[model samples]
Target: MSRAKRKIEHIHHALEHDRDYYNHFDDIDIVHQSLAKLNFDELSLSVEAGELKLSSPLFINAMTGGGGERTEQINGEIALAASETGIGMAVGSQMSALKDPAERNSYEIVRKNNPDGIIFANVGSEASVSQANEAIEMIEADGLQIHVNTLQELIMPEGDRNFKTRMENIQRIVEGVSQPVIVKEVGFGMSKESVECLWNLGVRYVDIGGRGGTNFSKVENLRREKPFSSFENWGIPTPISVLEAKSIHKDLHIIASGGIRHGVDGVKAMVLGGEAFGMAGTLLRVLLQDGRQALISEVEHILHEVKMALMLMNARSTKELHRQPYVLSGKTREWQEQRM
Candidate 1:
């Protein structure tokens, strides 16, 4: 299958089957503050990712590219939202455009719409350093994201299975690229050991694409000709990944993803040491179901909720939220205890 066809299939599969993988691990909770003196208007949300200074510590996350006209439309809307809100955005894997130059417009639409906003180009870890460089140039990205998805690749019918040379590719890309290289997981969260490895390799930003949001494994299973139940529920949970990755590398930039829903969840992620947050499944649902205006309303609602949480915590900014103490309990606590 071609990249464009695969892109469409992936998006449709994600919309249909991603929700089943959302494990309702309710034991993770953020204690509410009732006696707070801060107001919502005083909350600050600016943060730096690589060379770009995001108005808010939030990104739309990588969604899709190379699909065709529909992919262009979706990316255009997302870019408009990012530009309007002053937040950064990431484009999905650009391998399609790299392989077939005709698909370039699907990814370029993002830059066309949000010409000044920080946009990151995404590619898989298996991609060669040359391919990675091409992907960045293809999108004229502010930064580059290399996604690691061992589980998804194993389940994906057309996915690459060789993982032994990934580090070599990462090292080459890190050394070869002029822009900052961000190593991210697809849905399976990055372990502390893995985080340390990337840090050692001079990679700065780490996106814990934890399993609570869109389960790429599950999504792949749904798309597979013969689904495998054994690999369906594989990966680190979102809260646990954030906690573990932070414990290993406190100074590194960690973007919390996977199952991030409302403002309170975003607050919990920040308190747990995430520098920023990624919202994909929720935003995609709104975009596909109700179009651009509905998606805009959803983004505004989440931002308001985030501001409210910050105010309650007396956190005047995203940086302040990181300093405030919060306890992890239930499943997240158990996972941390065992891993730590």
Candidate 2:
């Protein structure tokens, strides 16, 4: 099948399926302070990564692209939300656009809609440095996100078999691109070991696309003749992965994703060391089910909740939000206890 058709199929499956099992955000808590001296209106957040800054940390991460006009329209609506909110936006894998010039408009719609917002161009790890650069230029991206999905690819009949040179490939892209290169897991989470590997490769930004939000293993299983249900519940939860990334290195800017269902979850991620939180599945569902206004409403609702959490934590800024106290419990605690 063509990339556009395949992209549409993936979106359909994600939209219709019940892929969530354990989010693990419930395993961590951003302890509240009743004596919070800060007011909600005073809470100003700018996620800092070294010298890089996001005026607003809330963002819509890429989940679909290059699936023809339908995908393009979906992207346009999401980009409209991002542009309206002043948060960053990421376009899904531009590989289809790279292979077929006809599909270029599908990805380019994001740039056309959100002309001034911080936009991220996303690609698979298999892409070469030149290919990565092209993906960036296609959308005039602010940064490039290189997604690693070994299991997702393995399950798909048309997916890649070679992950051997991914590290070297990432290093090349980070060196070749003028924009910052961010390595992200595709709903499989990132461990301290993985973060260390990327850090050693000179990649400073990592998005822990943890399990529990969208399970590609389960999604792909539905596409197969006989599903591999055993692998469905794989990978570390989002909160645990954030904890693991926090333990690895303080300088490694972390972007927490996967199963971040609401703004409260976003707040929990920050306390666990996420510089910013990404919501793909929830945002996509809202847009598809209720249209553009509903999507904007959802984003505003989450941002409001984040402000409330900040007020409760007495955090005056995103930097101070991370300094507030939090604790891990339940299975997430067990997971960390074994590793720590």
Residue range with the least summed lDDT across 10 consecutive positions in model 1: 18-27
List model 2 lDDT by residue over 182-248, tens digit each.
8999899988898888899998899999997878997788789877788888887888898898887
Q: Which stretches of candidate 2 lie over 4 Å from their true place?
A: none
Q: How many residue pairs clash in each candidate?
A: 2, 1
What are the lDDT scores of the predictions, listed in order?
0.83, 0.87
Instruction: Say which candidate scores most in lDDT.
Output: 2
RMSD of 1: 1.7
Colliding pairs, model 1? 213-258, 213-259
Against the hidden reference, what TM-scores do the models get? Answer: 0.95, 0.98
> Could you tell me how far off, in angstroms, the CA of residue 85 lies in candidate 2 after the best superposition?
1.0
Candidate 1 Cα outliers beyond 4 Å, as residue runs: 18-25, 49-52
Q: Number of the top candidate by TM-score?
A: 2
